[model samples]
Target chain A: MSLQEVFRNCAEQRRSALIGYLPAGFPTVSESVGLFEAMVRGDGHTPGCDIVEVGLPYSDPVMDGSTIQSAAERALRNGFRVRQLFDVVSAVAASGAVPVVMSYWNPIHRYGPDAFARDLRAAGGAGLITPDLVPEEAGEWMEASEEHRLDRIFLVAPSSTEHRLALTASAGTGFLYAASVMGVTGARESVSDSARELVRRTRAHTELPIGVGLGVRTAEHAAEVASFADGVIVGSAFVTRAEREGQDGVCAFAGELGRGVRTASPEPAGG
Target chain B: MTARDLGGAADPDELGSPDSGSHDPDEGGHFGPYGGRFMPEALIAAQDELAAEYDKARRDPEFVAELDRLLRDYAGRPSPLTEAERFSAHAGGARVLLKREDLNHTGSHKINNVLGQALLVKRMGKRRVIAETGAGQHGVATATACALLDLDCVIYMGATDTRRQALNVARMRLLGAEVRPVSTGSATLKDAINEALRDWVTNVADTHYLLGTAAGAHPFPLLVRNLHRVIGTEARQQVLERTGGLPDAVLACVGGGSNAIGIFHGFIDDPGVRLIGAEAGGHGLDSGEHGAALTSGSPGTLHGARSYLLQDEDGQIAEAYSISAGLDYPGVGPEHAWLADSGRAEYRAVTDEEAMEAFRLLSRTEGIIPAVESAHALAAALRVGTELGPEAVLVVNVSGRGDKDMDTAAHYFGLVPEAGITGEDQQ
Candidate 1:
């Protein structure tokens, strides 16, 4: 199913979608695929993950925290390549979970954007989540994504001005990624109070789903974010758990986080 | 996930033709396929602001005049072109002239870029400046500029570098700058840069990232190179007056390629002058421990720009090693990659041993102690001099002095005596 369908289904149930991220070929190609599959296979009552963001690792992950950096380093050391990302995406898609690629722009640019987009679509990827690429400089990527009928997801930070928010909302599709904090990706002690305001401001521009990421670590944090956001995006936390205790750890943590999104006490509307 | 067919549909060539030869970067900060603003979303506004201010500053007469005054009076511009006569004996009787950047204030060519950026920070009304250092020369220079401008300064350095170049760390601290040692991802120049960039994104509002080299994202390579262009402009005239014409070749070491590009700009339009950049060869290119990005690496992006970098098949950056901390970087400036690809310049790798030999030779023969980084260029010049013979004239950018590298040099050469040895006996 497309990412838009996933979000629509979650909204119909009055719950936010649970999105999980894992870098392709982390630890090993087969193991990372297995971990992602586990995340998507929910506890039967509620889906474990409504969507999956398979990370295409790059040499310098400036936006990533230490956990993701180490995970990507291991993936790179194991000879992970762009083709492996397609392999992971194909598997997740086959499992009936929507797969989107989270990547820095360089690898795609190096691999040719049009070819990457075409190949990614064939592999059944729903869209792309480019963390480092802003809409202002995403002309080439926009053209490629449009030609391939792939969603172009862009990040909107709390620091974004109104004009930037409007531009990002217009350029993005599938969902607008809201980075809840000003820092790099990692679990934090507290979610920034500014995130609510950012989401409200972004809503003024477009009706697209806004998924908040960066520092959303625990189930409590997930539920708190789910109260307002259309999706609760968890990345480094899962990778951190996976590093400590393999696939089983990811499965257990994802189940708990999935429950958190489904059982969240929605805040009073318009508050 | 099953592996799909290795289809011909994914043609690498479909990425299209290579970038055309352009002297300056395009609007998006690309130098051919090399440089661009590959950064997170938060810093886009800041980068745009910097690019805009740099555009205005470059055109403003008052800004130009003030910068010129500072370069002349404060940083001691018009550095001399000294002929290394005694040193020429080992160079097969070739005439070698040194562009004495080592004589500049703070003892390195980093002063030029630091002063210019520091001036910009003041103009931008930013009260704080942050920087990254490898050998600590840039950090020292940044600290000096911040002190002069009364701006708050913080420098990030690799923990290993902080230990090796402890004296330089102390120098920066004494100049009232806070020195933070980074201990991540190989704990070297590249790691320090990562930490600095993180700091920039977090504190971009009140802090200006004073990038030291002619690399990184847009405006930086252009701004830093233009700031140090005087090195070439002065050397060009000095060499012309001394030899009555341009030299056959110009050589400088490439560590982020600041000094090399600075000197090369003077002779780039004069096609006859062969521009050669000396990269750190470490043990050797075959040893898998070198910073010879142009010679051994493929096109990839790191830091903020696409350039030649030492990376694995998976595009993960590989660790680079060199005796000189300054030259031990995995990536080269995008413009250098462009020049190498366009056949405008040639690059070679000089082994650590070769650089050390030149380091000692220059001190003993010419009474000039060159930084280990500059010695890489001197080492390459030795071979080039022999190839061109006695009639050839060559100019080498002595980018920095050896004071900061004294500990490394002393350790490498065993200049420090044992603790128990008496002074009289040592003599």
Candidate 2:
């Protein structure tokens, strides 16, 4: 299914979409595929995650915290290549979840954006979420994504001005990634107060789904974010859980977060 | 005479070709195929603002006058170009000259870049400055400048470097800057940069990220090179007056390629003068434990710019090792990569053993102790000198003093006493 379809389905169900992230080839290539499969299909309790963001590991993950950095390091050490990202994506997409790629821009540039977008689309991937690429420098990627009919997701940070927020919202297609904190990606104890304000400001520019990420760690945090956001994106938390609990741990944790998104009281329209 | 008078005109672009415009980075911050603004959405505006401000500051007469005054009165500019006669006998009898950047305030050419950026921070109305350092020379310089300007300063150093260069860490603290030790990602220069970038993004409103070297994103490579261009300009005129002509070769150590680019700028348009850069060949290129990015690396992007980098087959950046902390980086400045690829400069790798020998040779022969980083250039000079013969005139940029490298030098040479320690503890 397309990323838009996934969000439409979540909106129909009166629940925010649950998006889980895992670096492809972490621990091992085959094991990461298994972990991703678990993230898509829950333990027969709540609905499985709505979307999966397969991380294409880069050498310097400047936006990542230690958890994701170590995971990426392990993945890179285990001979994770960009081609292996397709394998992970194909498996996750086969399980009926939208698989989007979250990568730094250099790998795509180095790997050739057109070829990467073509290969990813052929592998049933939905789109790309470039953490470090802004709208101004994304012309090449935008053309490639357009050629492949892939969604180009861009980020809107809490530090973004209204002008920047508008520019990003217009440039983005799949969903607008709203960073919940001003710092690098980590599971913080409390979400910044600015996140909600940022989401509100971004909503003034576009009607597209806004997914909140970077600091959401627990079911409670996910539920809190889901009260307002259209999607709840969890990355380092899933990687950390998968590190300790394996695939079953990923399912249990993702299931709980999925339940949280379902149980949260949605905010009033335009509130 | 004032120090500025000894250096001729202070116009940075005057020494280079007016028609070529070779020194300026293109509008997109690219130097040929290397360098661009590969950054997050949050930093595009900041980077653009910096690039614009730097463009204005470079052309502003008042800004130039103020910076020239600081370079003269505050940071001790017009550092001497000394003729190393005694040391020349070992370099195949070549006439060797040393650009004495070690004589500058804070004991390194880093002062040149630091003062320029600190002045820009003040001009931007930012009250706080943050920086990342590996060997702590850049950190010390930044802290010194911040203290002089009364700007709040925070320096990030890798946990490993903080321990290895504890004296420098103390010096930074004494300069009233907060030192934060980053314990992530190989615990080195790259990690410190990551931490500093994080700080900059988080505190973009009131802080300026004072990047030390010529590597990182846009405006930095151009800004840093311009700030330190005086090294090459002064050395060029001094060499001309001393030798009646340009040297056959100009050599400097290349980590992030700041010192080398600084010295190379004056002679870049002069096709006759060979520009040589010596990189750290930690153990040896064959041993796979080295930081010879230009010699052993491929074109890749790291730390926000496309540059030659040591990486694995899958494009993961590999850890670079060198006895000199400053030279132990996996990536080179994008402009250096451009220079190497364009045939404007030649780069060679000098092994740790060779650099140490050069370090010892310079001290014993000329009574001048060189930083281990600079010793790489000295080792390269020895080879290039022998190849060029006795009539060759060469200028080597002594990028920093060896005072901060005593521990490493003592450890390398076994200069410690029976107690396995040196200094006041023995006294």
Q: Chain A vs. true chain A, TM-score per candidate?
A: 0.97, 0.98
- Estimated TM-score per prediction? 0.90, 0.92
- lDDT accuracy of residue A199 in candidate 1: 84
The positional error of residue B192 in candidate 2, measured at the CA in angstroms, is 1.6
Q: What is the lDDT of candidate 2?
A: 0.88
Best by TM-score: 2
Worst ten in a row by lDDT for model 2 chain B: B1-10
DockQ of 2: 0.51
Off by over 4 Å in 2: A76-82, A109-114, A161-163, A203-208, A263-271, B1-22, B418-427
Cα deviation in Å at residue A20, candidate 1? 1.6
DockQ of 1: 0.42
Question: What's the C-alpha lDDT at position B100 in model 2?
Answer: 96
TM-score, chain A, candidate 2: 0.98
Which lDDT value does model 1 have at B281? Answer: 99
lDDT digits (tens) for residues B182-281 of candidate 1: 8878899999998898888778889999998888888788778777777887888899999899999999999899999989987887989999999999
